[model samples]
Target: MADKEPEALKIRREIGLVGGVALVSGTMIGSGIFMSPQFVMAYVGSPGASLVIWALSGVVAMFAALSYTELGTVIPESGGDFIYILRIYGPCPAFFAAVTFILVVKPFSIAAMAISIAEYAMAPFYPGCQPPELAVKCTAAVMIVVVATVNILNVRLAVRVQVIFLVAKVIALTVIVIGGMVEISQSSAIIVENLNVENSFKGTHYSVSALGMGFFQGLWSYAGWYNLNHVTEELKRPEVNLPRALLIAIFLVTGLYLLVNVSYLTVMTPKELMSSNAVAVTWGNKVFGSWGWIMSVAAALSAFGSLNGTFFSGGRVCFVAAREGHMPDILSMAHVHRLTPSPALIFTTAVSLVVLIPGDFQSIVNFFSFTAWFFYAITLSGLLYLKIKKPELPRPYSVPIILPILVLIVAVFLVLAPIIDDPQIEYLYVTLFILSGAVVYVPFIHYKLCPGLLTKLTTFLQLFLEVAPAEKNL
Candidate 1:
């Protein structure tokens, strides 16, 4: 028998450690750092508390990344959290998660990036020129088309572009860090105040409750480090590379985040950071004098780079889902010659453009954060379940039990804290959005896209194999 030609292994294993690192770093470093400080300042009154929030978020993110490393090494598949959940839980929940990603997470994320890009792009030429809503929509459309074009042409070419943009982003951030440090050294423009834990805790304005709420928001900004797992199949020697890539990426991004936040605080007082809409731009103006335009240009490049990286990685999740038969068949269809998932790519880009019309950047971030964390909580549960039920399964890389437990604790806090503090209408809107996936999942299952008998048989074998002793197993 012919070996079925390895199931059409079209994706080249050209992505090495550098590419893996780039994917993880590029995806995580996007608009979050640029926009999230304002939100963090609003939540936590003092710069010290804000820094603590980011530092704690880094630790939580590291735990989450370790948990994903265990799963990604075991599965070594492309669909990421979707695959992990499907293997441990069942098809129904996994299908819902996958649908939620396509319908909400991916599109909103892309739109958020595009909006950042458009805002940054216009800041220079138009100087106080805010484009009409329609113009912003057009800009988003153009961005989607350009990113899609680059990706479909070749994966290697696409990654090269990702590398260039990611490096540029790093440089832009470094510039800000240097600029801010210089400003701080020159004068006492920046304030450094220690939070009086006792009084701050007692005061309703600076209560522990408020800090906890702020911590959750800070955590959301640092959330996407695990997204690198979605491309595991394309990574060379994923067993070794996946875990290393995640750890390194998270560490680098965490340090960069701390430095960037410190820089923002160094140049602008907390009041200035909080009040200014364009915090980075304002910082640049303070430091560079007449050359503030240079910082605006850098911000624009940073946002564009982020937009490109986001679309490149986010689109892959949908493509992998479609290839697995959990989504529309057309999404699985690749370009015959180029070997790119053209249908999924186009579909994701189209949705991003549509979502760009309605809301500003923060709205999209809130929507994505709410849904992304919901799935993240589910993914962590799946890890714990598999660890208990399939303890014997080979895990070349395992998260220490304490870390996974900590991750679970933090994840639970992240989910509930948002609802407790904000309870913004958008929170309900996000919940409804996730639950809406069931609407499609039910009808699809009824039609037997996933047969009940097959699911039951798979579950039975899994349970039996897990529980059966070595002597009795044979």
Candidate 2:
């Protein structure tokens, strides 16, 4: 044999159906359920309309998740919408998506979840007052480092941690549900009044713009249903498990979210719920009495679980983008022995920490939806394109065309409602920043004008991280 081909490191298919369900549900359940119900109530102005919003949001999410199951099966890649957009719309649109996600969406989301974890974890210590900013940030930073380390060391271990946190989250929500049901059965004066059909529906707003924004807030709570698509290559069986996990995860989460919201209403009126910042904590205090700090700890653990899922998926986006030449080459590599995408994980952790430094939680949540749904619409449109234009392509899991069409309409509504009804200069600034990626992409990615300094940096990192370029072992 003259020269044997050098072996390239391959990604291990370590995620099974259970882990897949955990990733999707785990990420969707955290922080949002605890906080977003208030936003939903505020936007809709009544407990009843908010409940409708929550139900409609779940319907929207279920439709969107089913549509994504088809896309994941068709493309069957690691970057979720990024890879789908690249294949269908081409690299330019895909670059805008990757750029927006990397710069704004993923970083702010990770930062928000980490900060939520810190606030709740510290709540028990500082009763009747807010946690210190420094202590919260320090705790968030440590949580970020720990989560990143687990992901960098081994994908399996990180996934196991996700499963554990997911169990904790479900248990916490279940207890809240059971407590609320008990209260409803007792028909306490408060529960009866709040649940009164006439009283509950008293102040529903019918404004076109308000309804749109209300959906925006409610859908945020169901945000991560498509997360499993981000690491499709690592999934055990994309065709079988992708759709199965989506169905299981969305069905379970939708029921839990609705029940949890009803539970909140059973204890607090819409106005009261809207006035409170942490809905879960308030409900816990009412149900658990003075020992409510236990809820805080539970919330923190749940947030930590979502944090791990976000890190797992966000790194894969960067790694896959690098492999596609949208990012630096070094980011595409995996550790030689551990085979984890350590470089990309570290990069995402750093960006998230920087974002956490000045993270404004509410602002991040609103705009994160603005940027996210914009790309979601684009990606779902790709599915329609394939069905019509590229009809010959293989589709292991197919959905009716109407599903994506409906979801795309909802996505467009989500993207435009906020900016149109409430014009903000920041929206213009963010749009410009996303388009500016085209300027950078042309010279750096298209023309291959990577700087000489980057070459030396890549070399140094290659040795320092012990990572080599990856290939499909198949």
Candidate 3:
């Protein structure tokens, strides 16, 4: 087998407009919706402000997407922010972003999503009992393998899987909205009075800094709006389709999220919202009577889709990073028959499995929410650099200069909010983790101290593994 010729591989451009939309929306609609409301309400201390922060987060995401359009369209590369930052800033910033994503953000996010999937999947069977912790971790580990296997086999099949879950999740959200509407109509007087009364916003714990922190927390629910951009190379008609899919997905998610929040508010007060860990399930029990278990299934499916999408896009960042010589070369190798980044998928899945043992979902969320926006701020800053440095570059899509500026401001605030609200050592630890990539890069790539060993390893990899044509650095 080692003597067998390596299979030729390249990312197939088969993902269409609908697939693109599904990817973006599927990645964004994770356990965040079910889990984030409580945290946001806790921070903001009111249902009204919680709803407002969600809306504002959506708007910020939309603007960020619009700013990203120019880069995704004009460059049309595989790595999203990695490529953008590389183009504008240099190799160092891009390497840091890729390392942070592959090492910390992506795997932690996947583990959290997988754990949520397992929690919802086991919820009905356990009833009043807490689901076994080992069972949850094992189930999540299995899901990580399943998703990785699907992507390793074929890209189209992976997208198809995403679309199926995406549709199921959408239908589930629609049902919840319809249920909320019915409840509102039946008790219009009470619901209307609850919504209109000024007391709704009169929580004693309201903190301005906490509201900023909450906005960032809610933004986590809207985090993966940029997933499609990560796979631009596989997207059909990326120039025209990328922007359309992004805008549609953002608007769709924003609307669904707002309606879902209103639905929760209609059935439960602000106090109840903060108290319930599973907001959707709570709403379902109140609204659907005996059929409430359906919501648990829906939550599982929602997290499943997000987990799959995370594997689909997150691996590409590592693949691109490796292809550019920032990491091990083996990860850049694509599958011969399927053209998938199989090595990258396997590496990402392995990390997720390791992280599953901890199963601390909220800690994962806090770490990711803080780090992801830091990259966003850096990417937007790079966009500003590109506009000034490469003024003559052809842009297929463009946003007002102010749009990127606005997002950058918000990103900076969100990135700093956690430390400002209540200073923590985790922020410093994450910073060291990100900067640690530089330690590897300096010895491995910049100095090229072990060129022969690295060459032999990459050659050995190619003997058994297929790879696409070497990708060029931006």
The best candidate in terms of TM-score:
2
Q: What C-alpha lDDT does candidate 2 achieve relative to the native structure?
A: 0.87
Worst 10 residues of 1 by lDDT: 465-474
Can you give the lDDT of residue 49 in candidate 2? 84
Compared with the true structure, all predictions reach lDDT values of 0.72, 0.87, 0.84
Give the range of the ten consecutive residues with the poorest summed lDDT in model 3: 465-474
- TM-score of model 2 (CA atoms): 0.97
Evaluate residue 107 in candidate 3 and report its C-alpha lDDT on the 0 to 100 scale. Answer: 93
In candidate 1, the residue pairs with backbone N, CA or C atoms under 3 Å apart (3 or more residues apart, or in different chains) clash, namely none
Q: How does model 1 fare in lDDT?
A: 0.72
Best candidate (score: lDDT): 2
Estimate the TM-score for candidate 3. 0.94
Which residue pairs show backbone clashes in model 3?
none
Q: How well is each residue in 1-474 modelled by candidate 2, as lDDT tens digits?
A: 589877878999988999999999999888888878888888878887888899999999999999999988888888988889999889888888888887788888898888888888887787657788899999999999999999999999989999999999999999889999998888677766776778887787777667877887777778788888888888898889999988999899999999999898888877779887567777888888997877888888888999899999999999998989899989999999999989999999999999889766677787788888999999889999888898888888899999999999988988887777777898898899898998889999889885798899999999999999997422
lDDT of 1 at 91: 82
Please write out the lDDT profile of model 1 over residues 130-241, one tens digit for every residue: 6566676677668778887887777788778778877988898899888767766786434343234442222224654466567656765565677667777677888888
Question: Can you rank all candidates by lDDT, best first?
Answer: 2, 3, 1
Query: What order do you get sorting by TM-score, best first?
Result: 2, 3, 1
